[model samples]
Structure formats: structure tokens, C-alpha cells
Target: MSNDDINARRREQVELNMLTVAAVAGWYIDTYLDKKSCRDSALSGAAYVNELLIGHLERFRQVCRMERPIFMKLCNVIRSKNLLCDTRDITLEEQLIMFLFTIGHNAVNRQVQERFQHSGETISRHFNGVLQAILSLSTQYIRDPSINVPIEIANDTRFYPFFKDCIGAIDGTHIPVFVESHKQAPYRNRHGLLSQNIMAACTFDLKFIHIQAGWEGSASDAIVLRAAEKDGFKVPRGKYYLVDAGYGNTPNYIAPYRGVRYHLREFARGSIGPQDAKELFNLRHSSLRNAIERVFGVIKNRFPILKNTSSHSFDTVTDEDINEPDDDYNTDERRREGNRMREAIANAMCDEYSIHTRRLRDRHGH
Candidate 1:
């Protein structure tokens, strides 16, 4: 009698467990069927493009980090080049817009999907597609400056005669980058943050002429400059570029005097005037080179995501990366010549600076 009763009770418990499992499974299936797709919304990708087509200029710029006309021009370029085409449901403009919105805000695929009312896969496809198209056009837009003297130096009294041969400013900035734990050591800068060392050559008007990106954060400015030269970034013969002390003081790549107050801050806020010609030269040099710093600031202000770029994992190297053979430059002889040239320039600047100082003191009755 005891065995029979135990066996019957065990069977009843098993049957009850099976019924509970079935009930839970049925609930999950019903919930899945009732749930709405994340992409189901009123403002579709096409609809958003149409709104932007008729929207205010400032509003479009605020959303895309570029003017609407520039945005349209980019779309036209990609389309004219046959790099991108209108999908059945989305136009070429919408495709480029999705990519721009994603990068402009550093929005991830999911965020973009929500904004454009499309599946994550769809958003990712167009984003990468537009990215490729833009990369293909880099050579067309980014180029070396013409051999002529830029107006910023040609027209300004402070720089005119001395910097008449100066073409632009060269500087390096660090941008956050993601890499594998083992690969992160190279990207870890002295500040203990993982970043990429991006070298920029820009005109005084805050326009980038040449950009060499994707270097490790720990990479030195000199190394990046060498790499850039190998990749065909040229400083015209007899002309030079203004750089900070981090770069080599070599021919056609002039750098500030090391161990001197070269940054603008050293001269601002009622700071003492330059003690000598070398100091004076550094002060003015830094002032002109400050254009590159301003360009970096402007870029970050326009795209705030650049300040903290944790949303996207930029771990891959694209075809746009330069892998050219090293260009033998910055040799000892070249550097020594560059130093002599710098000393001459500094000495030449002293007479003008003294004359300007005399005029200022006389005007102030000092």
C-alpha cells in the first residue's frame, strides 16, 4: 500500500510541473507576438529627409553638424560618383543623412534606428555605405596648400615679412579610440587614456589641408610627421609650417624654441613681455600656430561626441589608412640647418618687435 501511494504522488507532481512549464512557454509566445517592433513610428527615414528638405538652415546644421547646402553637395557628390544609390524605400539623401546623424552625435546603431524609424540592420548598412563613399572622396577634398603665401601671413604686419614663406600650421591632437586589452598599451597616452594620435596640417583660416589619423596615442609628434610626409604630405620648397616643440625643428617644418614659453597662455593675462628676441619669436610663433588649436576646438564644439567617444568602438583600420614607405627626412644635417634658419628668423624679428614696442609705449606715455 505505501509503494503504490508514493508512485501515484510522484506522477501527480511530474504532471503539475509539466503544466507549469507549458503555461510559462505559452505566456512568452503571447508576449512576443503582442510586442511592437522598435522601428514602428511616424517619422520614417524618408519622412525625416523630407522635413529636413524644407526645414530651416540652422535647424539642419544643428542636427547634422553641417549646413544643409553642404550636406546636399555631399549627397550629390556620392550620387554623381555612383558610390551610393537610392534604395527602394530610402533616397540617397536619406542614406547620407543617417550616416551624418550617427557621426554628428556619435549615436550608435540603435539610436540611429530610433531616429530614422528603421531596423538596426538597415541603419548600419546605410551608415557603412555612406562612410565608404565619403572615404573614396577624401583625395578630392583634402590636399596640400598651393605654393603661394597664404593671406593670413601675407596681409598681417605681425607676420608679413617674417612669415612670408610660412604656408600653414601643423599640430597633433589625441582622440579617444577603442582597442583590445592587449593592443591598448600602444594607444594609452601619458594621461592614462586610450586614444589615437591625429596630426593635422591646416591653413590659418582653420581649414584642414592634410590629416594623418590612426596613429597610437603614445606615438610621438615627430613620428607622426614623418609618417605624414611618407604619405605625400608636402611642405612646399622654401616654405615652412609652424609646429610646437613636439615636432622636430627640421627643414620646412619649423618648431617653437624648446624650454621657452611658446604657448599663448604664457603671454596672456598681463604676463611679462618677451625677455629677448628668442622669447619674442616664440611668442609670435605660438600665436600663429594657435590657429590649429582653434580648429580642433571648433571641431569638438560642432560635434560634442568627440569629447567622450565611448559610444562607438573604432577598432578597425580602413582602406583610407596610409601605409607608404618611409620618407627619409629630418636628418641631423637638415635639423641643424633648420636651427640656423630659426635663429636667423628670430634675430630678424627683434628689430621689428623693438620698433613696435617703442610705438606702443610712446602711445601710452610710458
Candidate 2:
């Protein structure tokens, strides 16, 4: 073998060896990726459904914020309405679970993706799909106030006739929000936090009758209420809604007298009872209107997402089955008669004020 021939043969051998190594490495990398993709798909498919079934019932309720029966009923409703259909990899139940879990926990898309072992895109897509489905059911779930008074209000003598025509309480709450710089000015409330002013009306039973959201935080409550009115927020000619002093005292809306101790806390803390007719009216008004505040409390407690707003733009509507009133509320003339009855009761209460105070003191062991 000549020196030149030997050198060429050795170089060719080295080239062949390098080519073989490269081919093997390529095949290994492709196989690893394929395996990873399949594993992820499998995890995503089973994570929500399997966990919901095999885990504790309380765990399911904790994640979805409803009992198992209620959750299943909601799923059936969505299915029957044709609001959501199963995809190749994700079922309707899984999609609903993911949606509720995300909202109930105020989780971001990435967090949901990790929990379900799905891609970020998949998480985003299904979350939006379920949200739209829920929105479609709003009309059916959010009902109109009945013509009769709720038992909670009717049973309370202080609120009965005074608030008989009052369908519900209306208020504007600041819900924290996130927006771009250009939009932040409008969204920033008086406290200088980015928020959206949401106007909601709830009955004495803590059921929402109307919800108007997406208003700028800087907007006043009255402005939002007026906007809602234009957008089909109607009050029957004889009925009214209780509102705070932020709203005007129109015939359709009743507001507490300004410069009065209207909060229930003040009355509970041994504050003086109504000193005059206006004060008496306000005291009764406050007592009835506080139901709306309690409704807000219940909702925020049930859905923590309201406390900590999510970046994703979504609206929430909570509807629990409530019994309807058996009969129509008192008529306008009867309500006026109720007003006279209230005045007499107030006088009697005033006459027995010392005894009531003594009882209060005795109860407190003071």
C-alpha cells in the first residue's frame, strides 16, 4: 500500500463513522420528543376527569365551588342546551371542570395548563369556550323579581310595608382590574387602583336579579345606574329599588336621607334610634337595603376570583335555585297604610325605649 492510498482510505473511514453517529443521535432525539408529546396528551386527557371521580367529594366542591350534584346538573344543562360539545381529546365534563377550577381559584392560563398537563393554547381555548357557554345561559338563570315580597323582608316588621314596593337593592362595587397604560386612567378608581365599577342588583335572598359590569372605575355609581337604565333596566311603574345616597331619590329609586346614621353597624353599636320622621324612614331603609351588601359578601366569599381579579377578561353570574313568592306584594294604597302603621310602631318603640335599652344592657351583662 502506497502512503497516499493509505491516507485516503483512512479519511473515508473517519467520514463514514461520523455520518453513522450523527444519524443515531438524530433518531434518538426524534423518539424522545415523540414520547414526551404522547405522555403530555395522555396526562391532559385524564387529569381533570380522573381526579374529579377518584378524589374526595369535598375536593371536587372546593375546586369547582359547588356540590357534586349541582356541578353535574350544570353540566347536563350545558349539554342539553348544546352550549358545549366534546372535542377529540377533551370531554364536556373536563372542559367545564377546567373552566370552573380556573375561575374559582383565579388561576392563570399557565397554571391551568400545568394542572391539566395541556398546552397553554389548549387551556386558553377551552376556558373561553366554557365562558361563552355560561354567558348564554345568563338569561335563563338571572330571573326577574317577582311581584310579591320576599319572606325575609316581609317577615321583618321594620321593612315590610316601607320596602314592600322595593324590588331589590342596587349598588356599584369596585372590582379590581388590569388594563394597558392608555386604558388605566379610566379604570383607576378614587383609591388609585385599577378597577371596574360593577353595578349589581340582588334580592333579599341573595339572588342576583341584574348585573351591569365593564363600566370604568372612575364612573360614578349614578352614571352607571343611568346607563343600566338605558340598557333595559326597568322598574315597574309602582315599584322602586333601594339605593344609597350616591343615587338620586327619584320616584323609581329610593335613597337614604343624607347625613343620617344609615349603616346597620352603627345601630348595632348602641347608637341612638331614629330621632325624627326622616331618620325613622332612613333607619328602615338601611335595614332593608343591607340585604344587597350581604349578597355581595356571599358572592365574594363563594368565588374568591372576585377578590383577586384575573387577567383574563371574563364576567361571572351566580344563580342558585330560589323559591318564588306565593302571592303578590301589597298594593300602593296598602303600602301607604303600612307607612302609617310604621309611624305608630316607631312611636311605641320610642315610648318603650328605656325598657329596650335595659334589656339590651341586661343581655350584654353590663
lDDT by residue for model 2 (278-340), tens: 676777778778888888887777777787766765233322222222233334765455445
Cα error of candidate 1 at position 24, Å = 24
Q: Which clashing pairs does model 2 show?
A: none
C-alpha lDDT of residue 353 in model 2 = 53
Best by lDDT: 1
For all candidates, what are the clash counts?
A: 0, 0
- lDDT (10s digit) by residue, model 1, range 1-366: 699999999999999999999999887765454333656788777888899889998889878889988888887888789999998778998888887787678787778878887776577677778877887898898777877878888888878788888889999988887687878888899999988888899999888899888888888888888888887787778999999887889878889898888777877857788989889899989889899999999998776666765555564323336454465667799999999988988988998888888999999999
- Computed on alpha carbons, the lDDT of every model, listed in order, comes to 0.82, 0.75
**Top-scoring candidate (TM-score):** 1
What are the models' TM-scores? 0.85, 0.75
